[model samples]
Target: MSGLREPYGRGADEAGFTLVEMIVALAVFSLLSVLLFHNVKFGVQAWRSGSARADELQRSVVTQELLRRLLGNAYPLIIKQEALQPRIDFEGGSEAVEFLSEAPVVSGGAGRYRFKLFVDRTRQQTDLVMTAAPELASAQDNSASRTLLVSDIDHAELAYFGAPSPGAPGRWNDSWEKQSDVPSLVRLRVSFHASDPRTWPDLVVALRVRADVSCVYDPITARCRGR
Candidate 1:
């Protein structure tokens, strides 16, 4: 009991930590705090990066679906001219395509409209645009509308395929120049930049109306297997 009392009497002096021990404890606590903060920061950054990539992917998917809808609804022929060979106003090139497309009634437009799809790439940026005008509209109609289908694309290409001539087979071409016929197939490819963090897949559309290839000299009306 006497020894216990002696130790208890010195409690005040032993209650506080020494200066060197305090400094060492503070240094250890600070190091642990720094490590925890850095770990949390890294986790937050990783989550942000993954979320941004997912968003970009979703946007690209929606854009692709819209494009497919337009291409799948491509109109075959607006009118056929008996006076001259039926020359469709539709033209498909390597970088652009112009043609007539059918619009849904639910979308507010009920009839066929002329549409043009083109890529605008400049200043290290890319945009996919669609311009539309009614069939009766002028070449430069003020009522024409434009829609931005996609952006941040690295490059894009358009290819068309159809019978090269009457009684011949179909083949892919960078340009569709058969004035009297429409291409049977259309393909689209888009590539994203390395740093864009977006992905683009190839799109291919088969037209509803296609040209008939097998034909012979017409014995009666002199039309070479027109469809």
Candidate 2:
């Protein structure tokens, strides 16, 4: 029985793991752990990046829609200074545009408002901003409220399309020179920094209410009158 290697003791197959076996097992486990951690980290990063891009795209859509509504409702508001000739309350330039529209940016109610859309530049970045006030308020009024439409913008360009004189063919102009008339169309071109991943399409809005229905136009004075 003694020569049979101790029949009651554990055999080689039934013994605990050896030092070399333990070391090899631990090494494999560590490698698998590292690979799993890296895969999880990459997945999280990709999700976050995708979420940010989706948010940016949504913001762009909302901003573009807002601009379209405001510019499409352009109203030909006639402003009469004390004892002066009546003029249309609209100013169009390459970098800025001012006009009266039926849409209200803040109130979201039924009323006419004067809006000034321009680009505000700072040391850090540039933004497209709009100032809104009541239609009766002057441009210098302090009651105007400012809203930021687009952030980190490269530039904003505005173009006007209108005729120079009565019965003349309308053409696109960098700046609107006729203060007594409203442009038939307003073109808004906004660009972001090259590093920005967001993009917006060019917005072209037609003025639905370009002339006052209640007023008669005077061909001689080039003004609207209650004829």
- Per-residue lDDT tens digits for candidate 2, residues 143-224, read 9889898998899899988885678899988987546788888899989888888787889888888676655656665555
Q: Model 2 off-target regions past 4 Å?
A: 1-15, 79-87, 103-108, 138-140, 215-227
> Each candidate's lDDT (Cα)?
0.76, 0.82
Cα-based lDDT at residue 177, candidate 1:
58
Candidate with maximal lDDT: 2
Expressed as tens digits, the lDDT of each residue in 1-227 for candidate 1 is 65555656488768889899999999999999999999999999999999988888888788777777777767656334456566665788888998877764444777668789999878868888888877667776798788887877778899988776788778888988546777878899888778766667788887775533233334355444342
Please give the TM-score that candidate 2 achieves against the real structure. Answer: 0.82
Over 4 Å off, model 1:
1-4, 7-9, 78-83, 104-107, 209-227
Measured against the true structure, the TM-scores of the candidates, in listed sequence, are 0.79, 0.82
Q: The CA-based lDDT of model 2 is what? A: 0.82
Model 1 residue pairs with clashes = none
